[model samples]
Target: MTKQQLFDDIEADEDWLTGLSTDIWENPEVALQEHDAAEALGDALREEGFSVEFGVAGIDTAFVARYGDEGPVVGTMGEFDALPGMSQAATAEPEPIEEGGPGHGCGHNLFGVGSLAGAIAVKRAIERGDVEGSVVYLGTPAEEVGAGKVYMIQDGAFDGLDAVVSWHPGWTNAPNKGSCLAVDTFSVRFEGESAHAAAAPEAGRSALDGVQLLGNGIEFMREHVADPVRIHYVVTDGGQAANVVPAEASMEVMVRAPDRAAVEAVSDRVRDAAEGAALMSGTEVDVTKTSGMYGVLPNHTLGDTILANMEAADFPLSEEQEAFAADLKETLGSPSYADVPADRRDEAAEAAMFTEPLDAPDEGTTGSYSTDSGDVSWTVPLGRFRAATWPAGTPAHSWQAVAAGKDLGTAGMLFAGKVVAGSLYDLLTENELLEEATAEFEERKGDREYESPLPADADPYELTDR
Candidate 1:
């Protein structure tokens, strides 16, 4: 089948796809607990005649679905986890579907659904004997907390793949061929003596004081690190009340660097600072490494191919979709919306298919954000692109992102599904393309092997200390 015919097939199944998106969105499963969503998509893949494997990486929510038996295994990565406390309803105005519940703030609901649609479409193409290579759908979980793919890689889930294609839902459409920062998430805990503020102020040691001192030390260290190194933190617990000298306090720190070694070096310095704070405050300190990810390795060969497919694909928007996006654009201030690339913005009072690359990465740029996908890029030749799902400049992890996720967001997801399907089709049919991608992967991975940022025995869900 031709690309257009494949796209038409996906369009015909739009309602089913939309239903899948809505169901997953409304359910709002987080990380390793995405059993329902994974089972639902697994069943869909199985119904389409793909051999499905559940719990491949020792994580119940993670799975792999495969079809065809031959060379050049093409993988499409899927994520179904949602963010915490972002449960928004599918309405024009902001409304929480469940008060203080999880929501698809990052659009992973669309992310997984679109990938499933692409994998199923590719399965159909293979069933017709039009494609000769194998297709695998990777149901990766815990992306919100950044350890799903890490665990999968450790479990050898991504082995034997020729190339992996993934897409993210965002404000603009472009093939990303750059590096994302590597990140490490950890926490520092301080222990001190609790005492009455007025009667035993001198006798009491302040854990909160240690936290503040550590934060100050980190701020001073920030100027000495690499230009791209980012160190940020929030006091998870800084004593219950101001009157009593608290016995316990903790601060969560997230350190991001352009590369792994840089992140490691900076993280070590941060740990030392925490220790220093403890020594000065006469309090005990414990530093716990929670989770981390590697920097993205750009695969120009796969990237160029996906970019060509994205440019060639037809991404038409409906009138209602255009109006919805326009309204969302209005909700954000003029300055914020103006930050969207001019080419992506609606011109002539209509939502047109974005046909050109943006001048700068849009606010919701995927590579601009740190993710474990950066780690996956190191394992195999992975290419990620963004499709225009929400209105221009819709901040990710927000109610606006959740609102657009229902409609226009879903359409953009379907558009990305087509791109993914088409790209996989090219990979399966064209041996030279796979070779090129593999060659690029080899070049980028020279002398370096895939080492997960998470420890060998680390459980992705054990983030109580994060």
Candidate 2:
């Protein structure tokens, strides 16, 4: 009935949560292909009397599970996608469980299971009549490659949600008041005449030339763009034989900025450069928008709530857990994270729990990466946090991250679950929280409407293989 009881409910399901995390971690699947992960978690929720809906947003791996029939609907987002080539055993060494294989480098194996534990705890509370609202478990897939949540929003999957809470694994724990960049991924393909290199070479219009020119144009454009704008590309199709005048070539281009308008502005220029390259090379070029996500609209109201629960929750690490974290810390290295203070780094490596203070969301702050949750945040007032699943200095999408997550991340996952469950309890019981979140959501959204950066007909799932 009380918040402590809600925490108890989460602790009661520790075995189930552990099993879920272990299962998903052992069988790593990359974005949009988390079939086994989705099924295992879905069945677990269904067995607990939650109404489950699969393929809600036309994404085969995406699903929704809900408990309770009335009152405010508090949704928690979960992702199960893993990264490629980050396989590692849960040891201090940089050894892979399967050399050159996929692994939970981003710690989504813990992420998905942690969020599920929170949602299920809320379901238990609802059954006890301690809460008067519904709990939603969003089974989001393909966050690494496919923007699964963005596609879900396009299909109205997030409609009628009161608030959405999220969590991720990181080197430090904090209420995530930080922001992520808005990003758009697209493709450009060039087609032209082909001929023998040695014979009639003058008659061939090289598509490879167009692709090279386009790359050159983008590289030249970097100096003219805003400081925060990031543009990168990869040649997916750069022709076959060197002796032949290549007839076809393609490139995958990605543009990211702090806001939607900036992303749009840079993307338009990239498109223009592609057209110019085609014109100069005497080749035809086709451009396609693949996927995108918006900047996260962090709600201070929801953040304060989650922060309180994060600090209030008991996250004691055992002696063995501390040793495990220390061991993993030895394998971690990050040039980007070089600025972390030496004392903080030394303490965080062995410290059991709690380091960062709960602070107000900083204005104009942005992280270098992008998440589809940013798309979901634009749709609703969202709160996201991080648990110290890995030791200090661990960088995401690496063997070190994948290594610590194998078993050392279990306690952190449970800690996140308790915090989330506790926060959901307050959201259900406190009307002022939702009212404030809604008011802030409207004031911040202003005239800006939610728009998909992808083309109208683009299939989000098609990019899963990448």
Candidate 3:
């Protein structure tokens, strides 16, 4: 079948795909608890005659579904976790389906389902003898916490894949060739002797003082770090009562940089500041390394192939979809055509790619945030694409994102699913393409080996302890 024919077949199943997206969005499972959502997708793949492996990587919500057994094993990734407190129903206005519950603020619900649709469609093509080689769909969870893909890679989940292609639901449709920052998340705890504030104010060493000092020291270090380094923290624990000299206090810190070495250097400075804080306040300090991820290694071969497929694919938005997007744009307090670059603003006004990559802010415009997908790109020839799902300038992890995720988000998901399916079909049928991507992967990897950013013996479940 022609590529357009294949895309049309998948698009014909839009209703079923939409139902799946809405169901997963309504459930709103968090991180490793994505069992129900994973199983639902697993069942769909199994019915389509794909070989399904449940719990492949020691992660309950992680699995791999595959079809065909020949050369050039192409893998497509799917994520299904939701944000902490964005539970909104499928409405134009923000209305929580479950008050203060989990929601798809990041649009991962559609991410997983749409990817499943793509993999299943490719499986059908292979079954009909239209394509050669195997296609595998990886069910990855907890991307919001920035460690799901890291743990999956560590478990040797993607050991034999020739190439992997994935896409994210966003406010535009473009192939991303930029890198994301590597990050480490850790916590520092201070301990001291507690005493009655009124009776013996001078006798007790306050742990809260140590915490404050640590924050102050970090503020000073901020001015000295590299230009692109970003360090942020939240006070996870403090004194329980005002009258009691706090015996314990804790802070969670996220250290990020353009590359692994830079992140490590900044992290060491943070550790030293914590130590200095303890010394000055006469308190004991304990540092715990929680989890970390590497920066993405962009592959030109894979990127160009996906970009070609994206340019050739059909991504027409409906009028209702455009109206919803405009409504979301107004709600975000951004110009109806605001954040779109000057060149793309006119196209956006004409309802084109909302924030095209050609108009992307910089080579590393997304540096302000980080993701575990960076870990995946280091191991194989991986490519990421963005499809406009929200208004032009709506920031992620907001009520506006949640509202748009129900409609426009699903449209982008469907568009992205077609892109992945088409690209994988090409790889499966064309051995030369797979060979080129693998060669590019080797050239980029050089002498470095894939390493899990997570510390030895660090459990993924530790995220829940906080």
Give the per-residue lDDT digits (tens) of candidate 2, residues 268-310.
Answer: 9999999999999999999888778898887778888888998
All candidates in order of lDDT, best leading: 2, 1, 3
Worst 10 residues of 1 by lDDT: 357-366
Tens digits of per-residue lDDT for model 3, 282-348: 9999988777988877766667777677777777578888777776666665445434456766776
Minimum summed lDDT over a 10-residue window in model 3 is located at 355-364
In candidate 1, stretches whose alpha carbon ends up further than 4 angstroms from where it belongs are 335-368
Give every collision pair in model 1.
none
Where is model 2 more than 4 Å wrong at Cα? 334-346, 349-364
Best by TM-score: 2
Count clashing pairs, candidate 3: 2
RMSD of each: 2.8, 2.1, 2.3
Task: Evaluate residue 102 in candidate 2 and report its C-alpha lDDT on the 0 to 100 scale.
Answer: 89
- Give a tens-digit lDDT track for model 1, residues 1-466: 6777778878888999989988888788877788889998898888889888887767888898999898778989989988889988766677897889988888998999999888888888888888787899999998887767888889988889888999888777777776777899987899999999888999899999999999999989978987878999999998888889998999999999877888999988999999999999989999877788997787777777777777767776788887777777666664244434455445512443333444234322324458888888988889887888877667788898888887778878888888899889889888898898888888878988878777788766676336
Provide backbone clash counts, one per model: 0, 2, 2
User: CA lDDT of each candidate?
Assistant: 0.82, 0.83, 0.80
TM-score of 3: 0.93
User: What are the TM-scores, per candidate, against the unseen true structure?
Assistant: 0.92, 0.95, 0.93
lDDT of 2: 0.83
Model 1 Cα RMSD, 1 decimal: 2.8
